[model samples]
Target: MSDHTINLNKAHFTISAPDIRKLPNDDGIEVAFAGRSNAGKSSALNTLTRQKSLARTSKTPGRTQLINVFEVEEGMRLVDLPGYGFAKVPLEMKKKWQKALGEYLEKRESLQGLVVLMDIRHPLKDLDHQLIEWAVESELPVLALLTKADKLSQGKASAQVLDVKKKLKPLGGDIKVYGFSSLKRTGFDQATQVISQWFSQNIENTEESDEVAE
Candidate 1:
């Protein structure tokens, strides 16, 4: 079986943090999922975990309003961040969420990496760039998933993936990207591999730190 198969399926909902202060104790390694409104963020999480309802898929945008946490193991988590660019949400509430997300991205020490989703057709919009900029500033590793790849032909999907990689190359960080399709389950293994590698690297780093402290 694949490495992520067991751990991802073992994932379970932990808590929802409406604000940064409400987040769980900053002790475990976390990888967050971020995207614009209706960009298939929730679907990607569900697909990764192999749980149909784990992340709560919805037809409406901006339904995910909090930082939803899922425990994959004793000290590992998957965070579902609020989707940005929801015009229907109130300005004040949007700002509130933005503040929380920004703080979490900028200050959360346990956050090991981020998985950003974007529609294959609309690869990187303005808000997506803004988020990428934040990740660049944070010096955080990232895996960009182009969602809804089933909407396009194989050649087109491949082209889109290359296009994204070309665009993100200059950002200057450890970033791996792939085309993902929740419907066809394409790129599932690649996505899982990225997750496994990132989590394992984090564990290795922690072990090295502990050894040095001894």
Candidate 2:
């Protein structure tokens, strides 16, 4: 396949659907970003896209209660999934968000990859593990970002990345782990390249299948 690169910086808001049913048609390639509340997911997304307000970082956790969509190009999109594990929210609201997240993961046919962000200091909570396991089971590629790496010393952050990798190695899926910091721009290139490659690979695969059908 050619070295096709996706310009994530060109991403623009498409829709903020309350649930999967309200999203755009399940076509093209979508890479979803998911994480616990307060994981700096919005910051990471803004850094990746070079757009300050694209994903809407909020001072309060659980502010993002919808499935946010941004289109990088015609057939390439980035999704900011609802944050999980925010205890301050009401139980019913939490359940609603969880239901939407679960439905999207299980049913979205255009979902080609998952980007699971976690605070580097507190990596991989129970919900994080569950999400990763589900993606692995579904045969979806995952790019696990250990966000807020700048909060830790380089040596400590590197060690944490290794530890997380060691733990996840047994899952035996296409999962890549990296220490990422939206503030420091740590792992920015690596993260962008991985996500871009996902889109590029999906396009190439679809093209090949179409050629075969001809």
Q: What TM-score against the true fold does each predicted structure earn?
A: 0.94, 0.98
* lDDT over C-alpha atoms for residue 28 of model 2: 96
> Residue 120 lDDT in model 2?
98
Q: RMSD of model 1, in Å?
A: 2.4
Candidate 2 ranges with C-alpha deviation above 4 Å: none
Clashing residue pairs for model 1:
none
Tens-digit per-residue lDDT, 1-214, candidate 2: 6577789999999999999999999999999999999999999999999999998988998999999999999989999999999999999999999999999999999999999999999998999999999999999999999999999999999999999999998888999999999999999999999999999999999989999999
lDDT tens digits by residue: candidate 1, 15-111: 9989778888899699999999789999999999899999998899899999999999988999999899879999999998888888888888899
RMSD to native, candidate 2: 0.8
Displacement of residue 110 (Cα, Å) in model 1 is 0.5
lDDT on C-alpha atoms for all candidate structures = 0.88, 0.96
Lowest-scoring 10 consecutive residues by lDDT in candidate 1? Answer: 1-10
